[model samples]
Target: MSGGEAYVFAAYLALFVAVLGWLVIHAFKIARLSRELAELVELARRRDGKAPAPDAAEARVAGQ
Candidate 1:
């Protein structure tokens, strides 16, 4: 490819990589927040004198 075409391709590749990295970081952040929310819900339940809900592993086993 010519010089200008190479530069354009490089720019596009850089932009794509940046976007992908951002999405991955965002996904991780969401997962962490979900875990934190679940923990908070369980704590609230316990504070109210109720049994904490089954976790993911127990739920999966019960589903089987």
Candidate 2:
């Protein structure tokens, strides 16, 4: 293969790796935020002195 072709292939590979790394980082951030949101919801429920209700998804299933 020509040098130019090799360079092009390497550049594409690098771009693919960079995109994959970004997706992984974003996924972790989403997971962490979800956990924080759940915690806040629980705290709010406690402050209101209300019993915990089923999660929305769970309630939907139970309703069906």
Candidate 3:
């Protein structure tokens, strides 16, 4: 491949890697948020004297 073409390919590959890394990080953040939300719901139930709702993570963990 020509030098310019190699540079262009490298740039595109770098961009793809960055986007994929972002997607992976975003997925982790979402999972963490769901777990946190479940914990918050439990805390709210305790304070409000209501029954605790099912945790959002239970099904996902159980399926594994």
For residues 1-64, could you state the per-residue lDDT of candidate 2 as single tens digits? 7999999999999999999999999989877766666666667777899876548534443354
Higher-scoring candidate on lDDT, 1 or 2: 1
**Per-residue lDDT tens digits of candidate 3, residues 1-64?**
9999999999999999999999999999888877776677678777899776565435644354
Q: Which residue pairs clash within candidate 1?
A: none
lDDT of 3: 0.78
TM-score of each model, in listed order: 0.74, 0.72, 0.67
Query: Least lDDT summed over 10 consecutive residues: which range in candidate 3?
Result: 55-64
Across residues 27-54, which tens digit of lDDT does each residue of candidate 1 receive? 8987776667677767777899988785
Q: Give candidate 3 misplaced runs (Cα > 4 Å).
A: 1-7, 55-64
What ranges in model 1 sit over 4 Å off?
55-64
Q: What are the candidates' C-alpha RMSDs?
A: 4.6, 4.8, 4.1
